[model samples]
Target: MVIALPDPPLLEPRVLGVEDFATKRGRKYGTVLVNAESHGVVDLLPGREKELVAS
Candidate 1:
């Protein structure tokens, strides 16, 4: 028997974070991290808001 994996969860547009931002910006994961570090933007991982702030 074989099992199939479910599709990834659909994310909204207003969300901000590394993966979402990367997908929106069409950038690689590492590139997003580097740009965020250089620009002082929070490098937020999914569901983790340690460095996020209201803008």
Candidate 2:
């Protein structure tokens, strides 16, 4: 049987906060940036380097 699903609603764009945590896959380490206000991710940066602040 085929099931039809409704499309998800779009989120309004606004100022987003970026955060990082410890992540490892096998022997690799990385960081992930996520939005503070909304339920979304901004980007994924390589290594556990310091995060830059944007004005």
Candidate 3:
């Protein structure tokens, strides 16, 4: 069974923190968006698409 998670709330991060991490060694990767000011997690995006994150 597939469970769909609701999309994270849209936030205008005052201080954006962008980072990339490996999900599987030499296989897959994902990006994490954070609010640098509040130190809160904004969103976790799957995949390594440069354009997606650039925007």
Candidate 4:
């Protein structure tokens, strides 16, 4: 049997942290969103493309 867990809820924040880091080191990159106020991780994106970050 297999089980999956739901992701944590995201709430409106006064301070947010957005960071893009290289995965494969220059070959690939990803984005990370954090709720800076509570110092909790919000979400991670597959790529750090400019269009992806804008939305």
Candidate 5:
């Protein structure tokens, strides 16, 4: 018999660190959102407008 383990729950961050940078060609922009407590990258948004990053 085989048993499957349940997936771990996701962590919710109270504080987020956001960073924005441009591609080498300067044609696209990328944004990174990190969890302050864990210091882990939570999300990455590429080729997105500045407004989206701010929001």
Candidate 6:
């Protein structure tokens, strides 16, 4: 008999911490979650565009 493996858990949208954001953005840059105060969600723009900003 063969056993079946369960599927991986789906990723929920949320504000990424410093390290996580950097990895996802593919660069070491400063980025503050737009909803850092409340929902803490950081939804990337369409096409995964990167933006530079001065802190």
Per-residue lDDT of candidate 5, residues 1-55 (tens digit): 2357675577899999988888988878888999999898889987467677776
lDDT of 3: 0.83
lDDT of each: 0.39, 0.58, 0.83, 0.83, 0.83, 0.42
Q: What's the CA error at residue 12 for candidate 2, in Å?
A: 11
Model 4: lDDT equals 0.83
**TM-score comparison, 4 vs 6, better candidate:** 4
Candidate 2 lDDT over 1-55, as tens digits, reads 2357665675654766555456454455556666667757666766665533331
Better of 1 and 4 by lDDT: 4
lDDT of 3 at 47: 66
Q: What TM-score, to 2 decimals, does candidate 6 have?
A: 0.20
Clashing pairs in 1: none
RMSD of each: 12.7, 5.1, 5.9, 3.8, 3.8, 9.2
lDDT of 2: 0.58
TM-score for each of the candidates: 0.19, 0.43, 0.69, 0.69, 0.66, 0.20
Which residue pairs in candidate 4 have backbone atoms (N, alpha carbon, C) closer than 3 angstroms, thus clashing? none
Write down the worst ten-residue block by lDDT for model 4: 1-10
Give me the displacement of residue 9 in model 5, in angstroms. Answer: 2.9
Candidate 6, position 41, lDDT: 41
Query: Candidate 6 on 1-55: residue-level lDDT in tens?
Result: 2357775564554544322245545555334435434545454332322543212
Task: Please give the distance, in angstroms, between residue 16's alpha carbon in candidate 3 and its true position after superposition.
Answer: 0.3
Error (Å) of candidate 1 at residue 12 is 1.6
